[model samples]
Target: MNMLRPACVLALMTLTACTQTWVDTKYQQSDRFATWVDSTPSPYRLLAGDDISVVLPFNVELNYKGRVAPDGTVAMPFAGNLPAAGQTLAQFGETVNRALAANHMTANAMAMVAVTQTAAHVFVGGEVGKPGELALTPGMSVMQAIITAQGLLDTARTGEIVLIRRSPDGRPMLRTVDVKALTQQGDPAQDIVLQSNDTIFVPKSSIAEVDLWVDQYINKALPFNKNVNYDINGARSF
Candidate 1:
């Protein structure tokens, strides 16, 4: 037991050093992730499931509240289906006007589209007091998300917060942040702004090495394969 203890401590120290090296080279030195933190995102585009209010002055009957369908379209009273997702409010209004013209409903139809309820979302998990999906508000930061999660638990590792986000091009990426610097030292650089579909994971101090420790301790305990596993009855069930 005593010999095993020193091995564990040495392993932890070695892992910590490797993590610090990774944070410096892979994250800090990378320029691709800088855009997400440094640059402000473009205007919020309409998304599926967004509640929109459309007003048409010439055709009052056509004016109604509708939600964007899963296929990125909204059914208008006279215009049929119009693409609402991936467009700003102004762009959506233009689309409605063009649709109205194409249908010969009106020559100079004016449409005003406003997003009554947005569809953006952020996910918080791991050692937070509350871990779940949160509605992504305009200009929400990482710190705000932690607060919304009811703050970190006593066992949380503040310095090892991980932010997982998908780039605009649809590639998944990760960034490491030090919450201690952001909160205690007042470092704005450490507080990254959150985006839609962003996931913030605040790991516990004991599992700060993340997947490595999980693979060592947790994965080994589970007796299962990619194809089969035991059910609740403790029988080998497919």
Candidate 2:
């Protein structure tokens, strides 16, 4: 069996930030998201931040890839802009197929839509074995990402590993996770599902000023409690 993961490239840098709010993993659940581990992924609905690819077998020259716009649409060469968000890849594929036929490009067009990148990613940085942007597959956990990074370094502070996520309004929400206790005490709570654009920075030592470090060093942000509640007939906006 052959497996692949995104390469880890790192640079030692200080984690600086401004005043931030933290949701500790000890007492509460930070976010609510559906997991798609070993399940049919076709049901995964498209979101604004998701990146997709469209392939028109009948018109290969018109093939294109791009991110779903915030307005819930994706612009293609001939298709112009089609409703992409709130629709599954399969559903959107059919939409593209019809658009090609309507445009007289092909009467029997079978277009395929694939996700080149999901809306979220798991970024591991700081004192780790190999820290970089790790792919955030569906149902991926924090522990899994840490292991993929080849486990934490000895100099890494296990007690205060920082999990930085974005609020819906786009503000950074800092959280402290104790990986040491999670592994030593058989605690599952600490191994949270990595959210969209979540950054797990393993500090070499305790962070006296979390806000200052995050504001100064971190760039990517994520949201919490995100859910896609839509039915076959209609779609929901995120």
Candidate 3:
């Protein structure tokens, strides 16, 4: 009996070790991931849909709020037709200044152009506390965006938050952010600068309990002859 007890104990230890090894192997395989920059520069440029405030200190009466037309130009009284698209605020100001000077409207006109309204905005959708479109503001940050969205939902996969941005060449780029790390670990690097037309998506938690209910409903809907397995293991479930 003593020898049998020792053999049983040895077998149990072997089984435990094997189980641990399997778990470790699975974890190692799942660890294949990539890290990205915490903060990135805004890739958005002035487009046809943007609204700008053009101020001419030389003539406040001539100061106007201009919206970029479909053809990417704004109509100004003295400035005539000026191209406002594809230029930054500073660049646009320089252009307007040059135009006014050329037309002899103001010899030394000091103009300040700013983005008063942005028609290009970022959409925050899926599993966030509040899923909606957020308007882009000057000097907006990712942290401010999340806050505007009312923070992450309880089922939000903080590590899997995705930022989708479009490049100048019109190619879409994706960046994964660890929002929990930013909030919990106080990692400023994770607080990225936000741009117009960017989309921030917070995916639902992979550990959602509703998946089991969905699987059950699917099993019920399947025909009896379909040979569907009702067991969780049979469904290859998460």
Q: Look at candidate 1 and give me any clashing residue pairs.
A: none
The stretch of ten residues in a row with the least summed lDDT in candidate 1 is 1-10
TM-score of 2: 0.47
Indicate the residue-level lDDT of 165 in model 3: 58
- Give the whole-model CA lDDT for all candidates, comma-separated: 0.74, 0.67, 0.67
Name the regions of candidate 1 deviating beyond 4 angstroms.
1-39, 55-63, 97-112, 167-171, 206-238
RMSD of each: 13.8, 19.1, 16.4
Order of candidate numbers by TM-score, starting with the best = 3, 1, 2
Instruction: Give lDDT tens digits, candidate 3, residues 1-238.
Output: 2333344344334432332231233422342322232345643467787888888886887787978988999888788898888887888888888888889888766788878777666667666677667777777777788888898778777875766555555554556678889989998777878876666666656565356445656656656545433565665322
Highest lDDT among the candidates is held by which one?
1
Writing each residue's lDDT as its tens digit, candidate 1 over 70-176 gives 99999987788888889988899999899889999887778988877767877777668887777776678999999998999877778878776766675546677
Clashes of 2: 12
- Write down the TM-score of every candidate: 0.58, 0.47, 0.66
Per-residue C-alpha lDDT of model 2 across residues 93-173, encoded as one tens digit per residue: 998888777877777668888888776567787668988777676667778989989998866778877776655565555
